[model samples]
Target: MSTLLLRLAAPMQSWGISSKFNRRTTNMEPTRSGVIGMLAAAMGMSREDSLDVFNPLRFGVRIDQPGTMNRDFQVVYQNPDDILPTWLTYRYYLEDAVFLAGLEGPSGFLAELEAALMHPVYPLALGRRSCPPAEPLVLGIRDVDLLTALRQEEWQASSWYQRKAKWQNITSLEIVRDASPDESGYAVRDVPESFSQKRRLYRFRNVIREQVFLDQLVSSENTENEQGTPKEHDPMELLEDDDVSIKSQNQ
Candidate 1:
């Protein structure tokens, strides 16, 4: 199976948790159900459409920039009047966040999704309709699996953000991915079953969390053979074998 890559960078993104009445809260990371919904929208699938196509896919994400949280107060009333009672709602968002998301599936299915995203039937958004992504969200397909692709993908943090990170000496990024049956991981109720408006259903999915040290990006451009041509190699083979490396206590 191959992987489809996405650069989910936007001024504002909000992957809301389960319905929380008037207080619509958001998860720290992009949720599996939220990403599935975005893809369904790109293919012009209605809210009542089934999400069987996504069942075979493995999802993963890396946080390039963990943006700060924000909140907004909104008035839901269509028309304002003294006769009608005032109604209000609160929504949360992650400002200036950048995320790299990967979806692993059959080569053919991933290709189909890539094409659909490039020429989306409906408008594509990072999370909500109001929060549209920057142009060209699709980052093409990768030949490797989901986890490895995310581990080797280039850093997508904004230039200013990178500069800010320098002051703090930040050198690692967090990765969250679907865990296999044998792997022990925490559970989050984020798998979408039915997207029907009347009944938005979800199931728990186990996920593994780890941090990868990003001292520098590893790419073919920087790696060359004796002939001066580009050389391709599996980055994970060159990196550590452990799930993740711990930061030094001295640092």
Candidate 2:
């Protein structure tokens, strides 16, 4: 089997499994249904199209950079006639997160997907329309099984994160993978049943959470700040500043 790799990095991403009307939630990692939907969109498939072709492919995700989770409060007008009544909603997202996603399947099918991702017929989003992915989404194809590719591939965290790690003198990374029925795994209701917006559906899949260490680290010396200068000595300071800004806006 051949595995197709994708770099899922964005400023904000949301992978909702059982999100309801007032409270939209997100998983710590990418979901299988979300990834398959992205692929279908890249292939120019309609929401009503059959997803059987992609269902057989084994899927997995590696948490290279588990960014911070943030929540946004929104007010939706319940009645346009009277703006006094509003619906309060809370949406959750992963900020500055990076994930390594893999799909193992027939070589020809995966090759087709790789081509489509490189030159997609439709714009691709991480999990929601507002969450547009960064460039270089297609990481290329690997000649390995799903789990093997997920475990062997190098860390795919963002450059800024790599620099932060180096400044902190940190090493190693962790990853998670989809598991078979026979293996020790947890069941998640993320498998796709139908992509139809009017009648959304989903099933369950087994996932194995594993923590692997990566001694090999990518050089972050070339990483530069916004002004093209070397990054600050303390990355947490910058992170704190961001937090303050976000909190002020929310207030």
Candidate 3:
């Protein structure tokens, strides 16, 4: 199988799974349905078109930069009359996040997708229409499986983030991939049945989570480990530390 890698970095993204009326939520990572929708748009496939063709492709995403979540408020007026009340809604988004996504399938099919992504028929969005992705979305195609490509790929986080984190010292990254039902994994309702806006449909998929070591790109730079390498940059390492702080604040 061949893998098509995508650099999914955006200023704002929202991958909602169970969002309803006034409140929309977001997942920490990109969702399968969202990725499929973007692919469909790239190929100029309408909502009524069959997504089954792409369903068999193995999908996976590596979190290169886990961004912070923030919420926004909106107010909508129902009627022109001054007496009418306003509707309040809250939307959540991931700010400045970056993900390395992989799609493994037949070499020919992946080649077509890689081309389409470069010259997409329709505009692409991260998750919502308002959220446009940064340039260079098409990373490249690899002659390897989804998991291997995801594991071996270099970090795709923003340059600023990498410099702030001193990525040279990082050894590996974490990845989550679609797993078969027979395998032990987390269940997520992101599989798309039909993307028709009028009648959206979805199913479930099993996800296997694991960590992959960074390649020589990182190790080579850190080989010296000399005093010149500044130890102050630690944004990536601060992820865990910030998480703990948030949880503690909640408690």
Candidate 4:
């Protein structure tokens, strides 16, 4: 059992889980669906073949560092009509996406999987259209136990990381990377350049549901919460118990 860590930082990234038309895009949290889509794209899997690899993923996520929770707009289209003014709108969501998983079986298959992710043939959307990744996303793969420990520690310390965690029956584990300098340099806080051709600029709107889901995904990787009954205290906690300490003064 190994885990994969991925770096998804990009200059122009958007992960829209639930967005509607007229470019009224709402950035949604990076969902299992969205992440899997990214994997499929990297692997060049056709729509028909994507689910075979995506549907049964045992999943967990830890957001080690959260990016600026900001939103920006992109002008999709515009028209001038005194009778009816309209603009195409799109929403962008920026949430640090992380994932961990155990493989289905066979260590030999890792190379194939990594190759697929490293050079995906399809267009990878982190979670939204407006938030397309800026460059090559980063990924790290390792064993489940080690990954779990690291993930748990990350979760314990941050409110942002404690969100966006999800549970799935993982068949395998693969992390995506942003290796392109231009693409990776983009951040969520960036505002797209305005187009002179457009008659209007549509402002992207933020939705709370996206935030909640993003948080849910990161917060879901809880090994302690899943099965283990809470031990009375951590070993360090026990040492701090002033009443339980026996001073060793054997000088």
Candidate 5:
């Protein structure tokens, strides 16, 4: 079987894997589902289209470059009329986010996939909720496999991804490795340090972390389908943010 390598990176991208809250959210890294969705969209697949083509394929993600993920949170006031005595807080947090993904399949299918991704019959999203892909590159691989070749490449190789033994039975995997921002690959660099520092001036890192934690708690507590009733929490929570409570302890 052959494989296709697609390079996805953008200045401001968002991949809301399981975001549930008033504030905007972003995935820590690009998601297999999101990438498939992007391809489906380019193929003019409707939201209801079946994803069987991509559902069973072997997949993996590599952290080529980490981009800053900044999301704004809105704090609602208790009283609409009250201004001076209003009790509300709103802010945003910025964190580094970057990832690379590899997909393997039949050679013909791989070629079609690469062309579809490059020309993108339609549109493409780097890996963000709000940002669209500006420049995406596709590398054709016939003799070498994606993960195998990537591991050998010196540009952004990582020991974690180099071990073939660890890849046994792993249809898919994601590696968050250290990468220099200067490396040539897919990367995002829109939210400058000045903006992040300016926002930090208004809200302490501890406070912002707390707010993120509170927002997660509130989100978990307020799960519903527009009627304000709780629904069954899915296992995909693994993809959700880590415990915000720990942020308090650090402070």
Candidate 6:
């Protein structure tokens, strides 16, 4: 087995689980379904395609930088003349966050995915089409289990955020991962059963959550590398962008 590491840092990201019409909300961190959707897109899998290929993969994530939350407003008008605030809703997302995602699977399939990510068949997004990810998305393959791989990976938080954490003397980071058959964990409805837009589906998944001490993680210079490093000039990269733009959509 092998683990594929992903540096899911984006200026803006939204991973919604129970989001529906009117108001869409984001989860605190990356969701498995959201991540899998991106992967499926990378492989050019259409909405009607089977998502069975992704079912066997075990997942885990380490929150290096838990970012601030931001909201978006969307308005709708039945017609040009009918515009008295007919519809208004709020959408929430995470700003300037960094996550180290690990997917454990067979080496061959993992390798295939690694290459596909490098040259994705379809454009990738961080939860939503408006939120694209930054460079160095694929952190390469790790020859370890899901939990160990995430634990051994280097810190992915921005430099300034790291400094702030150090000053505050923060020692641990939140770690969440898919639970094994014998492992106990809380249940979340994130496991992807289907990606068909016509009738989107998801199943319950148990995930183990724990705190990993800062010392237990590897430190790095945050350089851009295959092993998941940030760009040299990354501050929040928030001021700049991965070419991210926001436009109000008519719901």
lDDT of each: 0.83, 0.82, 0.83, 0.40, 0.47, 0.88
Worst 10 residues of 1 by lDDT: 224-233
Query: Candidate 3 residues 128-244, lDDT tens each?
Result: 999988755887798999987887776777657777666567656779899856788988999999999799999988899988765523342342253233322344664764665
Off by over 4 Å in 3: 80-84, 167-171, 215-251
* Residue ranges of candidate 2 with Cα displaced over 4 Å: 80-84, 166-170, 216-251
Which stretches of candidate 6 lie above 4 Å from their native place? 79-85, 222-251
- Candidate 4 lDDT at 49 equals 48
The local lDDT score (0 to 100) that residue 153 gets in candidate 2 is 73
Best by lDDT: 6
Best by TM-score: 6
lDDT of 6 at 151: 85
Give per-model CA RMSD: 13.1, 8.1, 11.1, 16.9, 21.6, 6.9
Model 1, 1-251: lDDT tens digits are: 89999978777899975757678888888989889988998899998878988999999999989999999988767455556556788999999888889999999999999998988899888778888886437878999998888888777677678779889999899999999889999999999999887988889999999888786455423432322521112236545755454665334
Name the candidate, 3 or 4, with the larger TM-score value. 3
Please list all clashing residue pairs in model 3, or write none if there are none.
none
Alpha carbon RMSD to native, model 1: 13.1
What would the per-residue lDDT of candidate 4 be over residues 1-251, giving only the tens digit for each residue?
45444444443345443345644343322444455656656777655442544323333343333344555555543456444455545445454433232222233444466677677687666654445553224344555543343333322222333333223322222222221223332223211122123421222211111011233233434643663433122336546755553455432
lDDT: which is higher, 4 or 5? 5
Alpha-carbon shift of residue 44 in model 6 (angstroms): 0.5
Instruction: Residues 1-251, candidate 5: write the lDDT tens digits.
Output: 66666555555566653344454455566655567667776776655545557644555556544456564655565656666544434223224333445676777777767767766666676544455653324545545665454443222212233233236433233452222234333323221112122231111111000001111111222222233422222445565686557776698
Which stretches in model 4 have alpha-carbon errors above 4 Å? 23-29, 48-50, 74-85, 88-90, 95-110, 123-125, 128-136, 145-251
Q: What does the lDDT read for residue 20 in candidate 2? A: 91
What value does the lDDT take at residue 26 in candidate 3? 95
